[model samples]
Target: MEGTPDEFGAYRLLAGSVVPRPIAWVSTRSPDGVDNLAPYSFFNVVAYDPPVVMFAPVGVGDDLKDSPRNAIETEEFVVNVVTRDLAEAMNETSATLPHGESEFDHAGLDRAESVAVDPPRVAAAKVAFECELYETLEVGTSTMVLGEVVYAHVADETTTDGKLDVEKLDAVGRLSGSLYATTRERFALERPD
Candidate 1:
């Protein structure tokens, strides 16, 4: 179970070991106004004080992917939460289209204008975070993008007393390969004081 940290081996190990990771359905707009959408499994919340989130996107070749490239160039992006109902569309957006191609069109998804960012968000998402590029880190073949959320959108159906209801949200998570996990079966455990 040990070997050199080569590209394929390392990725397979890490991706397989991480039981279930949240998918960041990110959207960005190219400088030329082309809207880009893609899903990144290597994503998570980084901070709460400033409400920051991070997503790591790997390059397709020598060039960067549209999501990261657009965010870097325009300094804005949106993270749309993928739910069970939107899983198929989210997967469609993951396809590597020609640079500047609109994933929204390819997936037949609708876009909604973001409040604090230029990039549009998926209209069907239950929750969306409008972010401004806070920082970027180069780690091997991936570019880690840290974004400070300036605004947020939450669907009324997914909220209870202004807080997100996980059951109602019904979010989906990314597993290894083409697998996905659901939030349908969940249990609560109170934290110790």
Candidate 2:
């Protein structure tokens, strides 16, 4: 089914069927040192050899989002994993805040220092990635920002036997519209030998 769609129609279709997209709760620091936080569903890890992660910030007509703008300016940002417990606070930071306003303070989310980046990580998140912006690609009306992972922090309690315990992390996912989902119940399948 080959079809051409206007921006709105294409976006709606893509957002609707990208089931259970992982939410990247990004924290970025402005050049003036103010912190901003927001969640983006158009995010995923693209490669492992160089540890590349991609996130798309869709422009509102022609304006770029604050997070991507900050990343472009500073070349660093932190991606925090959203858990069920922090879903409400994560959603709060999604509100449109004035430039220079700290989303950490506005949303009441705690901030923690990163090991390899200037931007701070969300303190309550079970997992956090401190990344350095590798490149910014202008695709149509969206900006796809690629990041090189510089450091990763995983809560000790959430790690078990050298693996991240998904159940213990209680990660939250984004759904269409204003809906969210929790990874409370999951089934595993092993690949055939």
Candidate 3:
């Protein structure tokens, strides 16, 4: 762990230590009108005041990923949360299809039109954020795209008195290689103010 590990080694270390990572099922429409859907485990919310989220999509042999490319070209994308029930569909969408291929069709997933963005979202997602491209930072081989969420959708059943219920959400997380986890475990820690 002291030496500068190779790219793959570094990724393995991080991916293993990260434990459970939330999945960002991103949807974007290419300029040619092809709909693309992919899941990025390197994703998280960066800010709340302006409602910003970021996802790092590593290049495929120095080639730009379709998600970042479409976001850059159209300046819009949708982040759909993956529920446990939709795990298979979410995983299916991650297949590396050729450019201009529609993952919505490839994965047999339904597309729901976004309100404020041109890209569509997964019809079954409990939560979806319609975001506008805020900035892109080239972080090594991966490109970090920041998006400013403009419109948000949340299923009524997933909330209790306006607060998210983790049990109701039943989201899945990525764990190392092909492993995945559910949010069924519970623990709590109060922040020391």
Candidate 4:
């Protein structure tokens, strides 16, 4: 089906109806020693062999966002999982802060040093992936930063027989503007043999 030819309208419609998007609660350390924390909806696991994850920072108004900048400059970052318990604090970090200012301090989040990367992880996060910057791709005004997972931390409560229990994780997701969702009910689908 053919739709309207305006980029703004089309993009808005696409973003609005994408069901639920997993949020990447990203933390990065600025060059001047400030820690930054923020959430990005445009995130996903890209590869498993090298264990790569990627997130995109959409250019607001005109310039690249802080997460992308810090990841590129520092070559490291931590992607924290947004669980129901930390949803409020996660939302607080989404506020637009002035460059060089840290959302971690703004949101009053705790920090823990990563084992494999310099960027710290959110102390209260249910799961955290410590990553080393693998690549950065500039797409129009936005920037996609890809990283290789060097270490991971999962809350003890969320682990069951060497696997993460989604119910215990209680992960939150992004849904359009000012809308959020949680992983309360889930189902498993298997491919036909």
> Of the candidates shown, which would achieve the greatest lDDT relative to the real structure?
1
Q: Write the per-residue lDDT of candidate 4 for residues 1-193, one digit (tens) a residue.
A: 5667364585567668786889999999988888899999989999999999999887733376777778888999999999989999998998988877888889998799899999899999989999999998887667889999999999889988989877688889888888889989888899899
Residue 70 of model 2 has an lDDT of 90
What are the models' TM-scores?
A: 0.94, 0.92, 0.93, 0.92
User: Which ranges of candidate 4 are over 4 A from the true structure?
Assistant: 1-8, 60-62
Supply candidate 3's per-residue lDDT for 137.
90
The superposed Cα distance between candidate 1 and the true structure at residue 121, in angstroms, equals: 0.7
When sorted by lDDT, best at the front, the candidate numbers are 1, 3, 2, 4
Residue 74 local lDDT, model 1: 98
Q: What is the lDDT of residue 98 in candidate 2?
A: 83
Per residue, candidate 2 scores C-alpha lDDT tens digits across 1-193 of: 5566664588777787787888989999989888999999999998898998888988733498889999989999999999988999999998998888888999988899999999999999999999999998988889998899989999988988978887788988888899888889889999999
Clashes of each: 0, 0, 0, 0
Instruction: Return the lDDT, model 3, position 72.
Output: 88
Would you list the C-alpha lDDT of every candidate in the order shown?
A: 0.92, 0.89, 0.91, 0.88
Candidate 3 per-residue lDDT, tens place, 1-193, comes to 2766564498898999897999999999999998999999999999999999999999733487888899988999999999899899988888888777888999899999899999999998999999999999988888899999999999999999998777789989999999999999888999999
Error of 4 at 185 (Å): 1.2
The C-alpha local distance difference test score for the whole of candidate 1 amounts to 0.92
Q: Which stretches of candidate 1 lie over 4 Å from their true place?
A: 1-8, 60-62
* Clashing pairs in model 4, backbone N/Cα/C closer than 3 A: none
Residue 4 accuracy (lDDT) in model 3: 66
Q: What is candidate 1's CA lDDT for residue 104?
A: 100
